[model samples]
Target: MLNQDVLRNARSPGRGFAAAKRGFDIAVALLALPAVLGVAAVLLLLNPIANRGPLFFVQARMGRNCKRFTIVKFRTMSAGQPEGGPAPRGPDDPVEDERITPLGRMLRRARIDELPQFFNVLSGDMSVIGPRPDVWDHAIHYLDSVPGYRARHTLRPGITGLAQVRGGYAEGIRATVQKTREDLAYIDGLSPRMELYILLRTVQVVFTGKGAR
Candidate 1:
């Protein structure tokens, strides 16, 4: 059974919180623009030799209200893996996939691959902090398999979020359920204080390479 508190907290926020969150997203995105761009520029120079694929990997992700949006990340996989290989086994599974280049491993470990999503945040497709978006395929599978899974889509997806920091990559239906709980908890407890906490944790995750895949 669902916890009433979780359900209550997961409800869409009032207009004030929504507005404040948007303001915060804009402020943080703007503040981080220089660094994000700098890294992207550096990666552009290095990636051709390092990874030997397109500079950016663009894929459709389920965003707020389950809308589809294209998310950008540095291409971390080798060029031309045949489509329709087995579904990704888990979130962290990609870290071990043979297609990942050595340099891609380093970038994933440093969380540098995700820097491109700052553009998504700036474009209003995402926030600096919230539930991370899922690829459309995973989103569809989980929507059917995981109860209350759709709840996480009520707000804009985040570049980093409670699930990424706390649970890392969810590997299966059970793990995805746990991640949903964390995400709902975050929504229930949304505030400047919590936002700040997630931001600090994100920095720690990035630097320590605690949960990158």
Candidate 2:
């Protein structure tokens, strides 16, 4: 029998799963932070001219259930932008080609720009594996465009996830929409196995430097 209660409850947030995932997040972040921080230090030394003095960049991102939190990252672009910087384009457009400094390019390509987000995970603002967070502006735009976008918020935003594994920083609206569908799919089919798969695939991408940039 299809349990309506189960299906209905599934539509809501999974507090138990989230709590368990938080444990996983903390364990992984603790294990990975040393290496991540070491690399960040090296990058900061190499890219002192970029982003002025800041080695780490932090920004407000909408997290699980539309909660706002500061997400940390390695600085990748200059602090200032012209009046109208490069407009968002499709996945094929080179979004970083203009805004990214040479060092920034390497950071983005290596996915090191996102290392500091581990701190977010440790702080309970994010998860190890789930939908990625977005800025408020982009989150609002996407929720308006995508029907089930809010469903993803039932779980904490992840540093790496199904959408990210499938579409690392998609450049176009169409690609974003496609990635949105993949994120929703993940929400509907949440499980430890799936999470591990996404994490493993994400690691593969990072090592191969594929689908990143």
Candidate 3:
């Protein structure tokens, strides 16, 4: 069980950790730039022919300290279709929505759709490892309903994180609460070793498509 006091007393990463994290993010982003751009270029050309939509998807997400930032990704859904309102999806909905194009399914399974977020890390809007950012509207909902939820925002959101590696799609309030706990645990135990572990596990998740939705 999580200790409530630990959550309440959680501190942001130290200056050294913060500096190292940002430096690492920039270094990794630079190293991965060519591959990211190559994928984006291919997707841009193929998206028009295969998916018939914009190549990129951008949406507002809650960043550290509840700030809102635009998160970019490859567009995996049919163009112009509305994903219902801000309400969380129910259990009955498909893990990857039926609205996903066939190519989108492949992109998602490969976690390629999320490659665009490396720019967010490069820009300092996010980290390479931290709590996954929540959609703005859903962040509001979770803030109201989940205890210790806001504590996860003490650090910049991430492209991948401990909660993401441990928890799957948060379908409802219950699942959101569970994910919140995992996020809080990660935040409480932040360290270089743990960060490395999450990064490594993320590679496995991407390759195996574990808990991806």
What CA RMSD would you report for each candidate?
A: 2.7, 4.6, 2.4
Compute the lDDT of residue 192 as modeled in candidate 2.
83
Question: What is the Cα-based lDDT of residue 102 in candidate 1?
Answer: 90
Off by over 4 Å in 1: 1-4, 82-96
Model-by-model lDDT, in order?
A: 0.80, 0.73, 0.81
Best by TM-score: 3
Q: Which lDDT tens digits does candidate 2 get at residues 123-196?
A: 98888888888665566666766556666687788898898887777644566666667777787778888988
What digit string (tens of lDDT, one per residue) describes model 1 on residues 1-213?
A: 557678766877789988998998888789878988898788778877787767887888889998999988877878775211224544323333688789888988998888889899989999989998876777878887777778888889999998899878666567778888888888888877888898899899888899666
Candidate 3, after superposition: displacement of residue 182 in Å?
0.9
Q: Model 3: C-alpha RMSD to truth?
A: 2.4
Candidate 1, residue 104: how far the Cα is off, in Å: 0.9
Score candidate 1 by lDDT. Answer: 0.80
Task: Write the residue-wise lDDT of candidate 3 on 15-123 in tens digits.
Answer: 9988988999999888978988999889878987888878888888899998999998888888885332243653223344777888887888888888889999888
Clashes of each: 0, 4, 0
| Winner on lDDT (1 vs 3) | 3
Give the least accurate 10-residue stretch of model 3, judged by summed lDDT. Answer: 84-93
The numbered model that scores best in lDDT is 3
Q: Candidate 3: give the clashing pairs.
A: none
lDDT-better candidate, 2 vs 3: 3
